[model samples]
Target chain A: MLLAIAQPLAWFLGFDSLMEFIAFVIAAAVAYQALKGYRLSKERTLLYLHFSFVLIGAGLLVDGLSSIVVLLSQFHRGFVVLYALGYTINFIAQLIAYGLLVFAYLQQTRNISAQFAATAVVSALFFERNAFAELILIFLLVYITAHTAMNYSVSKATNSMLVFGAFASLTIAHFFFLMFILVPIFFPLAHIAQLLGFLLLLGMLLRVNQPS
Target chain B: MIPGEPGSSTKPVSKYRSQFRIYVDVMQVIQREKNQAKPTRILYGANLSHDRLIKYLEELKSLGVIQESGTEDKVYSLTQKGIEFMNNFKKVESFASAFGFRI
Candidate 1:
């Protein structure tokens, strides 16, 4: 497929990091398209799902750009401060994306009130500097865990493999980050995970389209 | 048959009313298709029966929610009105969610 070819071509062109960023942009486009589709369908659950995807895509795009900059050059001491600030912003964006996803899932399950409260709390907590990152990560872990559980609860849903793949990829990426080995490794792995996730989701979409 | 007229019987008015209602419902479905811009895969995620789906599809095609893409197993997509309706539906959903109503 075009996507499969695009991935390696980006690397060969000395824009490996940029490829990941481009993937984020692609995701954003897909999300936007899906949002429009959901709107046309008048499907509330699908709308929220696409909205969540849009936020996630935006976060990934920001993270991708930051990684690209880091990969291309070393930052000076003063630049390090700027980079740190940027990292904080990126982290906050990611947290917001995760929060939106939680809300989307809750809406799908018809648990609107709980989702609303959770979103507000998560958003508020994201602003607190002390322990903010750790808190957000904790919340993200909880959300992912809960999402997996909910997915399991729905027997008719398809393409769970994609979900598992994404989770596994993220887990490995985070593990590497914790070890402080090479930060660049995380970006590529995350992209791989996202790519797999999207493919899996596409499969699910096709399944839904299948005739009974 | 008209029961009271020359040994003929007729269907009740209620039956006619029900039929009219169904016709209106089908028209709404058709209108939904007419408004979409692209051929969209209409997934009956709610698992409607084949008979019901066929009826809905027929109505939608008539209303232009969908159109025959080609000679192949004609694919269907949404028209502009369909898209607008969908967006409105999403707005309602968003509003409900804002109120913690769970869609």
Candidate 2:
């Protein structure tokens, strides 16, 4: 794993796990909000949103746990495989989660068939400790960002703007992750950007639940 | 259930309104009319046919979300339960709308 060199950066390992944990909590909150909306309105789109965030939360939990395991083992050679496994699982989870989100958007736009095509291609790619997986995630986030951006443009609502900012930040974070291959320093930067993205989502959730 | 787009116009948006949504719509109309909505007002406000309006109004009353008053003209008003439900629904709707999902 390129991030295997994350050893010298070991001091930052615990922080990365903490960040992932925070992201997981925020994702779960978003999922719960979506579920509440689904129950009230019986909207299938809200159900999709619920499932997407559930997957995201699950992925973060797994990644954070594996990071803790690796850190506790003091980078033992036997436990090194856990890092790869965790990354692979996390990557796959985010891929499906984001893919489902894109489907929800496309379904709203009456573009159902495209989801199937994208899914078939994505399943074939699977997970790898390479740029391909990250690229796929970046692609999905970009689509979601564009959709939220269009929504913000139309509604001119603060909540919509927050969502657009969240996805946009996530997309940039993944780009930094992809660049981490060349510049090792990009690792912590990627995690920081990703945390910022999740924080934006938490802000949106809080604002939505505020009394009006 | 088919998920309708937020602002789509290909078909009647009301067709996609679920039972819960209808309930909310009816309650919103009553609230909008200063909590003293007439049958005709709700019929148009909720964009429901006369028959459906009566059916939903009856359901809302049975659920204790609304009450009917007046002997001659007849007026509808939201109960405390209905008011709270609408308040919570507003929050959920805002949350969903943030992500461009219509509920």
Candidate 3:
């Protein structure tokens, strides 16, 4: 929602390109913070995920600059090539991020085979163009769903319904965004869903870190 | 001098052993502070009681694991040893993660 509002406002003020560049820089900075946190905690897997975020942020920055250049120059072929390259870079970064997340999850659970299956699905979604991205999105949706279900089951057993509900909602919100990629019409909705998911995850982390 | 007098070396042995235990315990608590932490925060994190925590604080002050910040409203933070200890904890945390434990 913020991005949507800011993008047009920046354009109206003739600062759209500059604002986009700033946003990319901010995103990269955030990724850097996450990476530093991981290092402080010695979390290698999370470090990889943060590194992916940095790559993706760089790609977005490049794409935004290229778009601005194209607009100013009346759609130059070079700008188009640059945009495509940026897209490819961003896609690869996202793939690595997802891979590291799944790998971390599997390592936590001691489930090697399950991790492999998840990795394969993620790889297909990343490498496959056309409907493959959509397919991968569906796989992510199911995966998050199943993960939430299992967490909920444990929560029920442990009689921590409230905690379970919070986690389940977060997982659902995350996958909901992934589902949106299947239907491009809902792309904006996907972004909103992601924001909500992040907020919820943040809440959960705070809860975990609370002095008890 | 008498065997149990001030000149005897045995008197310092018991004091040194106790000091050594205090040093080890303080190091363990300091190692847990992977991120920056105030003395009170470290006190709570290690779950030390009031007397025990005070003792540790005093010992750490002498050894320089922590230093007092202000005169009126004093705050304490880690010194070099504390930082190194925390880094060691990070290494242990990474090892645990490899075994499917999210530290």
Candidate 4:
């Protein structure tokens, strides 16, 4: 879900929502592909991947809708809290989504129990609902980014490189999210980076399905 | 359990195909040969030894994805389910490969 800028950026009002909606579409498409794979092959890893992207898609949809609602409501005091609510939901969804990805990778190489990973995901729910949430997301993205980077190193496939670039972009996006607190300008930059990450994934998906 | 795949006991030495992967490989070889592949063709295409090929062929037959014909000079072809499976599998493979994963 990339935990977008969340708070109103003021300058780029409706445009950010549109970007997130586009990202949600990409995430949902990825999730749908994973679901098809799971239904056909019944692979546990594909199931994990399906759930991961579902959470991401759902989070983006919620956040985007909330932003649109707030904008339409003219930023009334009651609507301002909706932004915070949207952020918290997206943050939690990202924690679970990225946690599932990490668990899949861990299970691929090792035999870690699902219970252990579930515990970590649930524990993330206890984090303070503030900018500190971005830090936790950044930590998970670092692990996932490093995993994809290592995968690209070994596989040396263009698709793998694109996946790595996507996660790397997301990692940068979250960093920009963290930096946005100090400077509001970082907010739109974070959304742009986040959208770029999903777009790279979309590019890889298109290339993969190019009837080779 | 092939090495480098999920929860395998062995460490990564080389890309040893798992039984599931081998099943897909044989099926794909059948599909590649216009869905009416001979054993030698599957053997050459999937790079399997003769003994393993017979064993897998028997397994696939039992699973009802393939059937044998021509008792004297046997030929293999995919069943409707097998054809549908390959079609679905192609999409799945493409999707997983995009994420650097093998299914």
lDDT on C-alpha atoms for all candidate structures: 0.47, 0.84, 0.48, 0.82
Give the Cα RMSD of candidate 4.
4.4
Angstrom error at residue A49, model 3: 3.1
The superposed Cα distance between candidate 3 and the true structure at residue A179, in angstroms, equals 8.6
Candidate 2: list runs displaced more than 4 Å: A2-4, A114-118, A121-129, B1-15
Q: Between 1 and 4, whose TM-score is larger?
A: 4
For every candidate, give the share of true A-B contacts it also has.
0.00, 0.61, 0.02, 0.41
Tens digits of per-residue lDDT for model 2 on A1-212? 62555755657888888999999999999999998887766677888899999999999899999888988898888887897788778888888889888888876766456648476547835666578778888998999999999999999999999999999999999999898788777889999999998999999998998778
Residue-by-residue lDDT tens digits, candidate 1, A102-129: 5655544444566465758475653654
Give the runs in model 4 whose Cα sits over 4 Å from its true position.
A1-9, B1-19, B31-37, B40-59, B62-64, B79-84
Each model's TM-score? 0.52, 0.91, 0.47, 0.84
The window of 10 residues in a row where model 3 chain B has the poorest summed lDDT is B1-10
- Which CAPRI quality tier does the interface of model 3 achieve? incorrect
Best by TM-score: 2
Which is the better candidate, 1 or 2, if ranked by TM-score?
2
lDDT of 2 at B94: 90
For every candidate, what is the interface RMSD in angstroms? 17.2, 5.1, 17.6, 5.7
The stretch of ten residues in a row with the least summed lDDT in candidate 3 chain A is A1-10
**Model 3 TM-score (B-chain only):** 0.48
For candidate 2, state the interface root-mean-square deviation in angstroms to 1 decimal: 5.1
